[model samples]
Target: MFKDRFEAGERLAERLEKMGPFEKPIVLALPRGGVPVAYRVAKRLHAPLDVIIVRKLGAPFNEEFAIGALVEGEPERIVLNEEAVYRLGVGKEYLDRVVAKEREELHRRQKMYRGEENPIEHLSGRTVILIDDGIATGYTMKAALAAIREQHPAQIVVAVPVAPPDTLSEMERLADEVVVLETPEPFWAVGAHYERFDQTSDEEVIDLLKKGKERTEE
Candidate 1:
């Protein structure tokens, strides 16, 4: 069992080195949770690191229930939570509203974290490694892949500390390569596997980016 996200990242870093040097690949991590893991990955690989913000569309009434996610790309893609939508009787109007709100949040985040920096480079003709702490619904990760795919990357990798067996298997269909460190059976919540699964703050995310950028620049 891993001590926490950092230790898990260290283990993942060692395994990823076998794949060879990153050379020019960019490490884009899903923010809030993925930052710590990606920090370790970027440091180990000597690759530039950045954040890719994604917003999940939760069900109406029970907002915690994820029904879909929104991501930005060359051509934006939306994968519906058809099962949840159907079962919950989530109407089109609610979805549209949620999407609009999320879009605004995404933009706000871009301005806040990124400032005047150039938008993340297109993944086309480049190796793109997508990092996340873990996956539960898989909807968020799926939407991320769809967004990345639109840019036509030469390769896409999904790297995570741990995930369910079925979720890991499903990722293969979306990414060129998947570097999963652990696929524990009878997986409980992602937090269960981590000894210190604190809610990562925005400041922590910023600190990671700074450290990662400096390391990669060198």
Candidate 2:
């Protein structure tokens, strides 16, 4: 088990550095958990850091269960879990409502975090290192990958501290390269692997981004 998200980020950074010679990769993180981990990685690699806002569209009856996911980008992307949607008897009306709500949140977050910065414009033909704290269902990351793909990145690398073995395998097929620090078995939750798993706040995320911007400006 890792000490915390910071430690996990440090260890993950070490592994990525050994992989070597990434082509000016921009680090895109899935907030609000992924920011801290990605911050460490971006600092280590001297890469530009940004957030990819993707929200899971919860089931109509049980909001805890994700039926699909929405990714924010130039043209917003929506990825549905067909089986789940069908099994749950989810209709277009429900999906439309969920999509709209999530889209608002996505735009709000983008404005709050980026504030007119055109990072998306620079993504084309650049390697992108996508970071998250860990993976459970992996739907969120999958949606993120779809959005990144729209930007036409030169390469997409998915990096995480820990994930279930099966989920890691799925991610491998989706990403050009997958770098994980651990593929723990019987993974119940991502937090179980961390000694101190505190929830990352919006303030914390903004601070990290500000710091990252300062680093890039230097």
Lowest lDDT sum, 10 consecutive residues, model 1, at: 113-122
TM-score of 1: 0.92
Over 4 Å off, model 2? none
Off by over 4 Å in 1: 116-120
The lowest-lDDT stretch of 10 consecutive residues in candidate 2 is 114-123
Question: Cα RMSD for candidate 1?
Answer: 1.8
User: What TM-score do all the candidates reach, one by one?
Assistant: 0.92, 0.95
CA lDDT of each prediction against the hidden true structure: 0.82, 0.89
lDDT per residue (tens digit) for residues 62-154 in model 2: 886778789876777888989999998999998999999988988888888888775656788899999999998888999988878777888
Candidate 2 matches the true fold with a TM-score of: 0.95
